[model samples]
Target: MNYTLTPLGDRAIVIELGNEITIATHNLVQSVVAFLDQHPFDWITEYIPAFTTVTIFYNPLLVLPKTNQTTSASPYEHVVNELIPYLDNLEENHSELGRTIEIPVCYGGELGPDLPYVAEYHNLSEEQIVDLHSKGDYLVYMIGFAPGFPYIGGMPEDLATPRKDNPRLKIPAGSVGIAGNQTGVYPIETPGGWQLIGRTPLPLFDPELEPPTLLKTGDVIRFKPITKQEFDSYKEDKA
Candidate 1:
């Protein structure tokens, strides 16, 4: 329940829950988001949840008219006052548990052209790299950079590698890669600098689906290694 309120532009307020990107902070962020979702203000437009903050955007016109000090105080002040009570009362245990999703990946070869580079960088064999990556626990910290792209955390420090100096113009969807101490899958084809080590056949983003993105923040991710033949079969099954 510890936080600081800061103004964002003219009509938004940011509630910073913690200073670090730990699971405890993540839970607090989720708790705040859940509280707002269940008890939304009429003037509030939307709320964006990040690693350690929840940004609430509002309509100043609606907010200004509702405040008791309409003539004396700004909309930002009024909104912050209204939000404090609710945030203070939010229970940390109210944060929902996330789902665990298994993703099958085909490592090396054409799909993961940078696998050798990562192996060499870590001074390990390509097979050892795959084993380390596949066995590590991962969490979806946030979705950003591109639509449906998941910024994951909890990658083993042993597999850590820097991003490519020169980014690729168009990485195919489902390409899994490591950057720093994190790992993620490209939900859509886009320019990226992460060192590609594998790829999944899953269609991670689809406009036709109810939720376009396959992953959401707080979800637990498991990577399963698949053979080239198995990867082909997965695609064929989907086709």
Candidate 2:
């Protein structure tokens, strides 16, 4: 339940739960988000959860007249005071377990142009790279950058690689890539710097769907390698 409250702009307060990007910090962030979702303040606008921080944005107009010291106390101070009590007992509120999702990926060739680069970078064969990547137990740390894009963690250190010096202009949706110690799938075609290693046939983003994002924060992800033929068949089935 250890945290610090800092003001963001005029109407938002950032609650920093921890300093690291470990599972412990992720849990704390989730706990705080869950608490706010269940017991939302009327003056609050929205809350954004990150690796180790949960930013709470508020409506100052709604909070102005409600503060005890309306003449002196700012909305930020009032909101901080109100939030401290709830956060002090936050450790008691545990978030529910995340859902495990299996994603089938087709590695190398046209879909994954950078697979060879990654293999060379690690001084391993392409098959070895695929084996290590597919066997990893990943977690969706957050949904960000682009709509439905999942910033996944838990990539093995052996597969670690730096991003491209010159980013690609338009990476296709479902293109899986590695950047630093993390791995992720591009939910939509966009410019990126991550080294592409594979691609999934799954449609990760659909604006018309109830929940547009295929993955959510705290979800578990398992990469399953698929053959080129199998990847084509999967896409055809979905189409």
Candidate 3:
């Protein structure tokens, strides 16, 4: 599907791809990301890719006017026009699949406070809940809400569950949860409403890390179930 570009405030431009959230739209978004990064304008500051759109941030003052054309009224329009040619000629990105990162989660009990509730909601056993979550291969569609938080896709329909009626005041970092047709984890101590299934031991956000955020758009994530004993062991090892 073709995309339309619109000015987002004064410093950003939002490209609207197809409204549907499918693999095709996501790939197209990534292709846009790849092209922008490869052929970057001097004023371009950053590119934020969501499920089906990429919002580009830039500096208006630094944006060099097109050499061959007359000055335009809106810098955003000029930027959009310059971008159109690159997108129009973009080929489908045939890059290899992203590396699958396995996250070990301690399922049930306190770590997964909503596990029993979720199982009952679907007439499923807690073991079945664990199996369904661990077996699914999730794709990182975007990182939003909280820092390092990943909005993932690819959960099987049968295991889909709704969010908590009342969200907790604070969900701890690494709390794995499902809401409606989507599933994700809380990267930091943040308020959220997704059904809690487990908790990962990793600190998804770290101030000392080179790129602070652990996951990125287009990454693949898979959960691995671990016993409480294993969870403690892993934590101690990291410590």
Candidate 4:
């Protein structure tokens, strides 16, 4: 992985991780995070990590000496130059981190209004569709589009369905869906077009909970097909 540190001001530097975010790439992100946690860099105020980049916020007033204020040199520039060498030496080490989560999904019927349509479109039985969707391993890319919404990859190529012709006005939270070559869980109820397969009782996002997101980037996921009764049971238990 390559990194580019850009100074936002005297107080912060945004580091861009020039690599695709994957389970294999998490080590680099973790390393940078670890460094920030231990290092007493008074200039740094915040750190935000995305798919393949981390932005660092800092304060110039804290890092610069009061006496050095006489010079026209920017403290940010000085810090960037000093950090460049260290960043250049950093290796691309991936974290051995990833968790597989089994999610129960009730397909067809009211839960999956479009399941029959999808099955017919692919000239396959609905059961086959369910099996195909549930059999594969999915990698969490990033949580976006809504809170706890996990953008996952690694769906079977055959299951690469497109968005609906007419998007629904409301898609329930915990709705498992597929769009194009990807699939995801809706963290909150909102309008969406991905083919709804089932609804899980698990809360994907809860503001009151610490680390509210159920799935994080770099985690692995698997779907387990369940009957409507099973889904109902799970929901009741959760409630």
What's the distance in Å from true for residue 37, model 2? 1.3
TM-score of 2: 0.93
- Model 1 lDDT on a 0 to 1 scale: 0.88
lDDT of 1 by residue, 1-239 (tens): 88999999998899998998988898888788778878888999998788888889999888876435447877887898888888888888845558988999999999999999999998999999999999966887777788778877888899989999999999999999988887889988889898999999998899999888888888889999999999999999999
Sort by TM-score, best first: what order?
1, 3, 2, 4
All candidates' TM-scores? 0.93, 0.93, 0.93, 0.82
Clashing pairs in 4: 11-58, 11-59, 11-60, 12-58, 27-95
Q: Candidate 4 on 32-139: residue-level lDDT in tens? A: 665666774667777765666666776767666666776676777766765677667766664655788888888888988888888888899999999999998887
Cα error of candidate 2 at position 162, Å: 2.2
67-166 in candidate 3: lDDT tens per residue?
A: 7345645677778778888877787663555668899999999999999999999999999989998997899988898788888888889878878889
Lowest-sum lDDT 10-residue window in model 4:
21-30
Scored against the true structure, residue 166 in model 3 reaches a CA lDDT of 94
After the best TM-score superposition of candidate 2, give how far the Cα of residue 222 lies from its true spot, in angstroms. 0.7
Q: Name the best candidate (by lDDT).
A: 2
Write one digit per residue (lDDT tens) for candidate 2, span 125-234. 99999999999789887888888788778888999899999999999999999999888999889998989999999898999998877888889999999999999999
